[model samples]
Structure formats: C-alpha cells, structure tokens
Target: MRVSQSMKPENAAKKLGILLEAAPESFREGTVTRDELAALQADPPEWLATLRREGPHPKRVVAEKLGISNSGLARSGITDPLTTAEIKALLAAPPEWLVTERATQAAVRAEKVRVAERDKERAARGASDARRSGGGGV
Candidate 1:
C-alpha cells in the first residue's frame, strides 16, 4: 500500500498500511516543511491547490495561520509538514500512482487465479462423471 509520487499522501498511506489522521500540528505558522521536500522538491503549488479543493479541513484556516495566502499555499502542494522521522512513519509509502497500479495488478492476478481454479474443478468433475458412465474408450 505504498504511495508513489502521483498518490495523495492520505491515499498512499491507506494502501501502505499506514493510517492517516489529523496531523498533530495542523498546518500553521512555525510548522517546518520537510527539508528534503523543501530542498529537493520545489514549488508544489499545484498540489496544494488540489489538496485545498479535495481536503476535508478548511484551507483558509491552514493558510492564514501559516501566514501564506490561501491561493499561494494551495498552489504550494505542501501536503504535510512532516519531519524526517514523521516522513519515515509513512511506512512503505510508494508514490500515489504506483499504489493504485499495483492494487489493480493484484486484483487482476487474484481473478486469474480464481478462474484457473474454477476451470480445474470443472475438469475434475467432468472426468469423474465420464468414469462413472464408463465413457472412456480403450
């Protein structure tokens, strides 16, 4: 259930066997952005926008306390202001898209297994019936 880059943190967490709850510190002023994201990643404004649109919490409350414009923060795409340890807490977090794709693949595999088992059972039953009727010609 790892979340991938394309997956929303919440969605990814669910798949990765991680639980998403209200972060201890709501996104407010003094909240430190993850250094890696701050350094390695830049300008996640679009993600912020998506979060605002999709999130359950109030975007304005989060933005105002953080001293950022609602639109600006929304566009910033900063999902969680997690520290290194907090980020690590997201066990097996894959990018969002990967989790979805992997789940889909697993479902397909399960279906195939089910179909194969059914076919095998049907063949076995048919063979048993043939034997009982003395239908096999030598």
Candidate 2:
C-alpha cells in the first residue's frame, strides 16, 4: 500500500494566495493533495479567483505589493488584510506612514546587500589566507 501525499490547509492557502482564515471552513478543515492544489492553481474556482483578484491578501503579499515589510504594516496599524482596491488607493495617494515605511524598507534591503557583500569578501580572504598558510602544518 502506498501513502497519499497531502498538504495542510495553511500551506495550500499560502500556495493559493489567499488568507487561511478567509478561506471557507470546509477548505480549512481538510488537507489538499498535490494534484488538487495544482488543479486549483491551473483553473482556480470562483472563490480562489475572487480572493486572488480582490483579496483580503496575506501580509506577505500585501508587503510586496506595497513595497514595505510585514513589520511596517503592523507598525502602521494595518492588522487586517487589505483588498486590492484598498491597496491601489494607498498607492494612488500614499500617506506619510507608507512613505516612511517604504524608505525604511529600502534602507533595510540596502544594508542587507552591503552586509552580504562584506561577508562574501571576508570569506574569500579567509580562503586565500588558508591556501597561503598551506593547512598550517604537515
């Protein structure tokens, strides 16, 4: 006998681009098979399509669309999921908080790149020094 592969509802919801809480109770209570998940993505049902088009989007999606971080959304008191219209509205006329948060997020991304580059250089130097030292002993 072979075991069937399945994923939890939360994982399915993430893959489907909808909030787990926003999904129907029936969907929430059941596990999704890989085929079912793929079918849903390939030809989304009304609910999934609506959720993706009009959303109640997850924080990660919202953050990416808004060019900000999840923490920034929380800091701006946006605890609830936002619909597409609401996201567009913000983009059309960004508030002071959104402006500030975008800048902060940009700075954070830049710093991360800088740190990664520095770490890479350090690692390369260490490798070079190791090669020169010839394993330190015979």
Candidate 3:
C-alpha cells in the first residue's frame, strides 16, 4: 500500500501568497496534494491568480516588500494584511512612522550582525587559548 503526499493548509497558504485565515474555508479545511499544489502554481485558479496579482498578502510578504520588519509593521499600527496597491502607495509617499521604522529595522539588523561577529571572535579566541594552554587532554 502506498500513502499519498499532502501539505498542510498553512504551508499551502504561504506558497499561495495569502494568509490562511483569509483563504476560503474549503481550502483551509483540507490538506493539499502535491499534484494539486503544482497544478495551482502552474495555472492558478481565479482566486489564486487574483491573490497573487493583487494581494491581501500575509504580514511576512508585506514586510518584505515594504523593506521593514513584521514588528515594524505592528509598531506602525498595521496589524492587518495589506494589498499590493496599499503597499505601493506607502512606498510612493512614506509617512514619518514608516521612515522611523525602516531606520530602526536597519539598526536592529546591524546590531544583530555586530553581536554575531563579536561572539564568533570570542569563540575563536577561546579555542586558540585552549590549544595554547594544552587544555584538551584530560
């Protein structure tokens, strides 16, 4: 006996460029077969095409296209998903909060990289010191 392959609804929604909660109830209720998913991607149905073309996209995608973090969106009072048009409008005429959030996100990313590099240097120094002190043998 062979089992069929299937993807969870949440993953399908992500691939489909929509929030799971925004997807149709029927789509949300069932697992998607690999073949079905492929077909959807190859020649999407009206709903899928509409969503991909003119999205009420998920927060992650929204943040990516907006060049900001998900938390930045929340801090700017954007708790709901945004359509492509809305995203474009904001990009064309960015508000003060958006500008501030973008800077904050950049600083946060820079700080993360700085911390990671510092930790890597510390680890390398520790390893070098251990070797020089002949500390490995018990």
- What does candidate 3's lDDT look like per residue over 23-96, in tens digits? 77888997998888889889988888787778889999899888899888888899888999999999999999
Clashing pairs in 2: none
Ranking by TM-score: 2, 3, 1
Model 2 collision count: 0
Give the TM-score of each candidate: 0.32, 0.85, 0.77
The reply for model 2, stretches above 4 Å from the true place, is 24-26
Which has the higher lDDT value, candidate number 1 or candidate number 3? 3
List model 1 lDDT by residue over 47-118, tens digit each: 444443334334444444343454444455645543333323332564454344445556766899999999
Task: Name the lDDT of candidate 1.
Answer: 0.46
Model 2 Cα lDDT, one tens digit per residue, 1-138: 866689999999998878999888988997999888989999988998888888999998898889999999999999888989999999999999999999999999999999999999999999999899996766
Clashes of each: 17, 0, 0
Put the candidates in lDDT order, highest first. 2, 3, 1
Residue 23 CA displacement from its true place in model 2, Å: 3.2
